[model samples]
Target chain A: AQSVSQHNHHVILSEAASLELGCNYSYGGTVNLFWYVQYPGQHLQLLLKYFSGDPLVKGIKGFEAEFIKSKFSFNLRKPSVQWSDTAEYFCAVKAGRNQGGKLIFGQGTELSVKP
Target chain B: EPEVTQTPSHQVTQMGQEVILRCVPISNHLYFYWYRQILGQKVEFLVSFYNNEISEKSEIFDDQFSVERPDGSNFTLKIRSTKLEDSAMYFCASSRLAGRNGELFFGEGSRLTVL
Candidate 1:
């Protein structure tokens, strides 16, 4: 079965700190990758997604992810973080093109950005 | 900006009782999905619906669980018999298309607590 793995369980950083959340998946075929964020008291929102083409995909709120097929990795990165960026980050994978919208999500990483 | 909506932000139910969670997907979305995250666990897919029927479901979605699009706007998940293990946050999501490249929009989750 396909599964996603996020390297961090909790990360704490001061404001303006550089951020990188590692994500890796176990799958042998074509895959779609996504990064979703959930702020306190807010719903989950899409931060970025990698479908095809350029390995680097940028998303909302200055976030980006790189899809490295060889390593089955799609890690999210941000150059400078704000206090508002404190949230739970999830990495997800869809194993094939025809699986409808079923997403296998990783154990979320809790990021706390101190102001 | 359109978004998915879920009702009863939190619900408390007794074990063995039936519970119904409701959701209203984005107006133009063609695919709907249900996912759940138990406290301290990764989010897991339950089911995906399209064209008025279930397109796919995960093993976690057993006989006790059922989904319905009772109307054009409302989609619901019914648990025939709630158990303590059923306590979790349930999220409803919708997308304009199927797996390939569709971006899923998620709703504020409904927290279910079974005693």
Candidate 2:
């Protein structure tokens, strides 16, 4: 079975501070990685995705993730976070296309960006 | 831009009662999915539907749970006998492409409270 693990359960950062959220997956096949963010009172939205290509993938709202296949990790990073960036982040993995595109998600990381 | 929509933003039902959650996926999406997140837990995939049938489902989706696309646009998740543990926020998602390639659009989940 494929599983995703997010190292951070809660992270507190001040405005303009650098941010990094660690994510790891245990899947033995070609996997698709994704980071989804849910703002308070809002739906989950895609932050970034990695299928295949350059290891580094950039996404909306100045978010980016690097997929390291060897380590089975896709960590999200932001150079500078804003107060508005306070939200819950989820890391998900889809084990190959044959698995019906089922995404196994990690326990979300609650990001609190203070102004 | 078109987006997914879910009904009864919140529903409170009693144990042993039947609960139905409705969703309207994007117009052009070919694949539909149902996921739920218990409070403080990871979002878990329940089932995936395509071609008017279930393509894949997780262990969480047992005989008590079912999904149907009754009409051209509405997709629904029905629970035969709800349990207290079934109280969670149910999310409906859709993607235009199947498998790992397509990006999923999620709806502002329907919160089900089984009391």
Candidate 3:
């Protein structure tokens, strides 16, 4: 079956540190990729998405992700992290043929930014 | 800005008891979805609905689980007989379009604890 994998489970970084979270998917067809974030006590919210365009997609909160078709990867990155950036990040993919737009999500990566 | 809303922020129920989680999706959205995240696990898709019918469902959505858009404003997921494993955070989401390219808006989830 198709699946999404996030390599890091927990990442700790100091404020202003650069960050990257790895994601890979196993679908063989066209895909729509997304990154979502959940802050403490908040609902899941979209950070960025990749439909079909330039491989580099920029999202909210100074976050960006690159879709590398060859590697089946869409990795999230941030240049400078803030203490407020501590949250759980999830990577998701939707197969092109799926009519319902159901998403397959990766096990989330928890990032803790210490001040 | 319009957003999805879920009721009963938290619920605790005995195993085998029936439970109904409710949601009100953004008024303009055409597609509705249900997803769940078990404690310390990845977010998993449960089902998707459109045009008053189910568009798709995952294996996790079995006979014990059912979804209904009972009215113009209310979407509900009913678990006929909850199991201990059913304890998780249930989220409701909606999108303006199908899988091609539409951002999903999610509601604050309802945390269910099946004791």
- The numbered model that scores best in DockQ is 1
lDDT per model vs. reference: 0.95, 0.94, 0.94
Give the TM-score (0 to 1) of chain B in model 2: 0.98
Residue B66 C-alpha lDDT in model 3: 94
DockQ per candidate: 0.85, 0.82, 0.81
The parts of candidate 1 lying over 4 Å away from their true place are none
Question: All candidates' TM-scores?
Answer: 0.98, 0.98, 0.98
True contacts kept of 1: 0.84
Native contacts retained per candidate? 0.84, 0.82, 0.82
Cα lDDT tens digits for candidate 3, B1-115: 8999998899999999999999999999999999999999999999999999998898999999999999899999999999999999999999999866778889999999999
lDDT of 3: 0.94
Clashing residue pairs in candidate 1 (N, C-alpha, C atoms within 3 angstroms): none
TM-score of decoy 1: 0.98
Docking class of 1: high
